[model samples]
Target: MKRFLSQKINSIILGILVMISATLFLTTNGDATIFHVAKTGKDSNSGSEISPFQTIKRGIKDLTAGDTLLVHAGTYAEHFFSWETSIPNGKSWEKPITIAAHPGDSVQITPGGGKAFFWITDPQAKYLVIDGFIIDGQNQAYHGFKFQSGPTHIRVQNTEIKNTKYSAILVSIPPDYNGPSPNTYHEFINLHVHHNGSSIKDHGFYIQSSHNLVENGIFHHNMGNGGKFFQASLSGVANYNIARNNVFHNNSQSGKWSCGLILSSGEGNMGYNNIAYGNYAGLCILHRVTNARLFNNISYENENYGIYVGIASTENSYVENNTVYKNGVYGIFIGDDAKNTKITNNISYLNGNNSSDKNIGLQKQTGTIISHNLTSDPLFQNAQEKDFRLKEKSPAIDKGEAINLISKDFSNTPRPQGASYDIGAFEDIPQIDNIPPGIPQRLRLIN
Candidate 1:
């Protein structure tokens, strides 16, 4: 009897070890093997180097959970997959998945294709990582990636996205089959959106009804809109987000209202330290939005207001320690029953019509604290040239709230030695040290 008991215990321990190994392998499922994408899997088999699958879609279909599908160097004109769920509808013994591009290899997904609904498989499969591919929107109406499901951890890193019709990376909660439809209230937390979206209309990534955080991303020339977050239901909170060091510029796509960074229809959120210039609107908050902070951002040279507050937006929306200049209209415009909103210690200057200088900064608004702001000329060495860095003796030097300098710095440019922090997106670094040679002076008549 003692011998029989010992054997049973040993068997249980072995089973537990197998389960743990499976879990670890699932999380780190990439960085091995080479999978090619052609037309079909049957083109070649044996999945080893001797004979690899031709297409990644086939490998994904035949793959179990914890599989990594690697695409080699080439261009794939196929529609890829449109199914929302990464988990196959019928598969059981599988794990989460990761698809990556081979190192030093480029996999291009050319668009103008089908209305493929889902791009990167299922959203329900948490811990899904898709990395290292060049996705070309090709002037098409489809998004580079369409995500649907509840992902505790989803990563799309080190990828280049260009010329997409909708958002390049789209994450949304699908119609919850179990509950009533439209139960999308969770956030896409810890998402790193970087180095994508070529122009103004090329939206980088959008979060609908998700309080996700995006960091270290580049959003350039996406004329449509940069990053968007909204909730269908207005009860929950989109809090504790950090958007820093991202550039939102050249979004000159002539839309009704284009915004650089926006926290619309969400509660308890923060949008700070972002550089939004040359867009239609630097930042916007509205539609029953509350408890949002707009701090330490530099918005300038846009077609309209640097910041606009829409109607029905009550208290807990604070705008402070920012620099707004040359916005073609009011540096800051408050509207639509926006009450008890705090706008303080900011630098709003060089604001007037592109045609005339009479209509200066700060348009008609109510319930705002427009205090301690220097309406005098900031005297940037070059405003229209995109050189927002303050020249020596510019009025913006030491022009901000002294309290904001304790922990954070909004100086986006390298400035002159012994020179103070300049207002706007760029810290006033000397052109000799920071500016590259022969980039052509881009000076303009901003004010």
Candidate 2:
């Protein structure tokens, strides 16, 4: 019968090549797995690497999706340390679920009275990855990392949140979350949030959740109440979030209503190359903010407005090329419920306290749009060691106007280098004539 039907079609192609070689040997040796944790180990030991595990809640109960617990050197006072129920969701973002801090080893967690010293409500805690670590909330934790019921791709890096008694990172979204805005894509890198809050509504990084991302952080001092009102060291309320290259300083303490970076009730929020100083308002597009976008930031010496577009209904905002200086008052303060705002190519100088204030204060010029701005002296190459760059005969270089999503400045360089933009957050380097043309003028013998 045709040789038994060609040996039954070669035994069904050898059983489909042995089921594709056992699924490529279980996708290359069954992927990840690296738990450990040691305070001289022993929670019934098994988390290998010399049978480690003493508690990070038993190495997070033997993590599931592509695991990795690490955690090695010292102090893990573990007061509330989280994760009692639902905690296992990392089948994506390249198999997340990290929890690091073993590389250079200096762990330290000290939770103590714990209202939070790392407390994630675990609504299935998405692709988690809390790297490094030194979360000390000795002030009796009121929060030093607290993400409520809506975790999304969380990723806290390099960590170093301190003293907490209020906020040192609290990505909210569960005060009965009414559906929609489930704490999206979180990510805070290079953190070093210091001293942490006390009152005045405390905060050191209190994102109310949205497409979050706070980069290169270094929020300082963190304490308030003595200032008796508002507070912040980086606070975004929600909506397309993004704060870049951060470095707010000497937060609250007593600088009054405080703020060293704040974007409220959001709507396309975005602050760039941030660098506020001695806070009390060094960048804030408050209240019902809309279309907010403060670019190339560098608010200086604050103790008052160095950028503060008022409350309630803030609209169509877009303060560009920022570089407000020596603030103590208006260096940019557009209150009266801001409308179509657009203070362009900024470089407001020597703000308030004298010389008749106002470096740019408009309580409501209807549909505001102050163009080409530059209240002189943008020559800073060293404003007494603060070095605000730009000093090659700086009239703020090309006097900026260009704004195609700000190609890059604030140290990342690459913005019009010449012929165009260069008003604030630094983009100066295009002046290289090097004087050698005179040698060619008399060399006519070559013809």
Candidate 3:
């Protein structure tokens, strides 16, 4: 029969050339470069500059995609490096590279006595960029800035993450058998995730897959979950994310549905103009969170409830100029089964001082839209010295009612005089004062 069909096509071309040489040696061993470590320093030929490469996984195993590894700024105690299984202590990247540090100097990747600084297993290998560093996870496994399988252009800026037991920037997901695209650009600008450990299930900044962006960061005293606003892991499902104008104060001692943000899982996330105060609950917009939008934020001295649009969400969104104060509960707590929600011009007050949670600022359990607010007392000169800036005949000034929050340029004065459009998250600086005219201005001399 034609010589047995030409030997069956030459045995299918030798099994496709042995599966293309085992996929090119597993993609070149998934990448490798070794300046070799063990406290490198023996006429180290780690490529110039005095035997460099003292671990950073030997310059991230010789990077690749637009490589740029240039970490030089002190503290490098890797006692005996050997990272190859593509960095997998917690998770992420393990691929794309551009790790920097040296502009204004500040690099410290300590873990000599229990290492695991750049632990990542390729969190979706995107365009990486870890800037001015500082990663000290001496405490081990807490998922400090990790990523499991999709590192798409992730950029951690002005880095400053400590301890690490669960949340100091632990991005999730990228391994459901891969299948994603659409311009992934995970970004965290100006980071400074604090002391670490919030313990009710730690987290100071935990993101889920989706074109992400966490802006102007600063999350202090994280006790347990200060910023967990998505659900792309443990089953994956989060969308176009963005948590802007960040600054969630003393992230209250973590746990028990802790807050300062724990949007708790998936659904087109978006928490704008953030500025949550002494947390106990400054936002817990729970599971299946909806169109998520907690406008011009400024949640106050929380002891509980300054916003908690809970489960079974839909059309979910409690909008408008926000500024919920001294909350003990009820500064807007619509979770009796959140539905059709969308409360506007919000302005909760001194909140119900834990009468087991009261003061009832606007607790609607169904379809919402509480208009033009000024729920009283918006006075403040120092909400713990971080200043929420407001206090000139404050009725939250002009009883603000405009609904397009997210305008802040103070100190640079790009556009002051909020037309008294003052609401929350500061914007009441119409207190202008510039006296130096006792004798100036051509010596008007009024003493």
**What lDDT does each candidate get?**
0.56, 0.74, 0.59
How many steric overlaps are in each model, in order? 28, 0, 27
lDDT of 2 by residue, 1-447 (tens): 233212322333343233212222112137678888899999899977698988787787778787778888888887444465445668776777777777767788877665665677666657888777788888887877778766677788777788888887877665544565554688887777778877756778877767888876677788741111111222334777888877777777665686777877767879888777778887888777688888988887788778888776778988999888878878888877888889898888888864334788887546988888888778887676666778889898998889999998877888888899988778899778887755555455665
Could you tell me the TM-score of candidate 1? 0.69
The CA lDDT at 358 in model 1 is 22
**Model 1, span 156-251: residue lDDT tens:** 555666766667666554533343223223222222233334454346666654445665455656656777665445334333444554556656
After the best TM-score superposition of candidate 3, give how far the Cα of residue 413 lies from its true spot, in angstroms. 11
Candidate 3 residue-wise lDDT, 1-447, digit = tens? 233212322333333233222311112243433222224433235643466656565556555664455555568754222235453121245444555664445567765333345445454545666666677765563545665555466677767777766577766665454554333467887676777763756677777666688876767777676787565434335565777767676674633557877654556677766767677778666766666677767676677778777665545565556667767667777755666666655567667763423534334367765566656656766544435456777777655555444455222232235564555544565655787657545555575
In model 1, which runs have C-alpha deviations exceeding 4 angstroms? 1-43, 48-51, 61-68, 78-97, 111-125, 173-203, 220-223, 232-241, 354-366, 379-385, 390-399, 402-406, 411-447
Q: Give the top-scoring candidate (TM-score).
A: 1
